[model samples]
Target: MILLDEAARHLKASLKDMDTVVLTPRLSQVYAGINGHADLLVHKLDDSTLAVAAECTDFFKNLGLHYNVMPIEGIASPYPGHVQLNIAVFGKWVIHNMKVTPEPVRAFYERQGYHFIHVAQGYTKCNLVVGRRSLITSDVGIYRTLKDIAPILLVESEHVALKGFNYGFLGGASGLINDTLVFAGSLERHPSYARIVKFLDRQGESWTQLQGPLVDVGTLIQI
Candidate 1:
């Protein structure tokens, strides 16, 4: 199953063969365009477990995946509140502002012995595009923080669109489905398109660019 933003419903035709769960603006606190972002609403604890917001539990209940409803009141529209579940989980390192992350999510990863990298940026997952062998991001703080620890590509943030915001993020616009990287829209319009293609080539990854200009529909959560 894959979780996608309802705003990108037009792309469903391109992904007609896949089982998709479209996230609508059910949560009042988050803005309309971002309310359905899987990175902000869902946390994958393990292969069979997922930590999700209370309002989203019903969506995953029948999918055969065990889910833990976050033990908090609804997410608020403030900076940290909306980012509670937006943690970036890499192979061995999990990056986010641990102080704001929900306890249930943190405890599970801690018990698994994963290294936690704390950054001032709360929306770590939205700012990151996790590839098989490397990482790509537009947030300078994230790039500097993980540069020494991982193979990372820092690209310009220009041209990525997000409604009601100055710009969107690369991570929010794309996701990796095994060896194939899936993008919400076209990368050819991006300023650093060539650099991004080169980075993907180096990682030995293929990609699927859907349609229209690149927009942040949040990371496509594939399970």
Candidate 2:
């Protein structure tokens, strides 16, 4: 099953063939628009385990996936507080601002023998787009931090839409479905369209460009 934000309902037609769950504004702690962002509400620790927020436990109960309900009430609206589960996992390493990460989430990853890569950015998952063997980001801190460890693609963050922010991120606008990268909006509207395509081509990756301007509806989380 795939989890998507309720705000992204317009893209449902394109993805009608797949089973998807739309996240509604149930958590009051964070901004309403972002209440259902999977990266903020749940973290897929591994193939079987998921670290989910307390408020969202009911949503995944019938999904037949093993999940741990976090101790916190919900994700707070403030910067670091809202990013508790917003970590990016690439292969064996997980990246995030370690200082603000929830203790339980951190401990779970550590127990799984995963290495933690620290970055200054709290919204690591939002700012990063992970491929099978490579990574992409617009945040310089994240790019600089992972450049040495992996093949990282640096792109401009302009033109991506977010309800309450200046701009959304590339990671939030796209998700990987098997080997095909699915984008919520058109890639041609972005300044780095050509570069992005070339980078994907080099990695032997194909992409599906949905119609409309790019908007960050968190990420399309497949469970």
Candidate 3:
């Protein structure tokens, strides 16, 4: 609770009553700042940087959150079971679930993608909600922030804040936040997007790192 508490220390607003909030994929990193506003926020925590993960390992714990290995475990029933979606795409971070790690992936393009979406550049789009709305977003960090900000406000507002405002909102990026927050666009662009959703739903398991109102991580794996 420390991380959540500290993040909420400066803001006096009741998270449950928030109307809306804008979040970026950078919300995944600990250094990225998150506002206690918005009734709902989608977020991320599935950083692929082993070095950064080691450095920021305790960051989430310090905030009262913990990170786990979420092992890929082996292939399950469907083999392609949970689609392996990435939040990075075409060397940019517009947000998509269709992209994969890419075979023989290009270094320059990938780097550009991160740069465009990284928190420092300010181009991440994802979050979470937990007050009163059904709580929907495409990012994991934002989702966590929503969890942190919730309980401080009313529940009514949080319930419907994310009902059905998301549609035709897909760009490019298979990263966790993008996969979780994506509404619709073209699974063809990133088949992994649909695959992941299918896999998660089939497995009946959900993770805080990739749960959005429109797209649930559980469904990603299940579908």
TM-score of every candidate: 0.92, 0.92, 0.21
Q: In terms of TM-score, how similar is model 3 to the real structure? A: 0.21
Give a tens-digit lDDT track for model 2, residues 172-194.
88877655678879999999999
RMSD of each: 1.9, 1.8, 17.1
lDDT of 3 by residue, 108-185 (tens): 245544422221112122222211212334444433434443221111111112123332122111122223322222
User: Is 1 or 3 the stronger prediction by TM-score?
Assistant: 1
Ranking by lDDT: 2, 1, 3
lDDT of 1: 0.80
Local error of candidate 2 at residue 107 (angstroms)? 1.6
Candidates' C-alpha lDDT: 0.80, 0.80, 0.25
Better of 1 and 3 by lDDT: 1
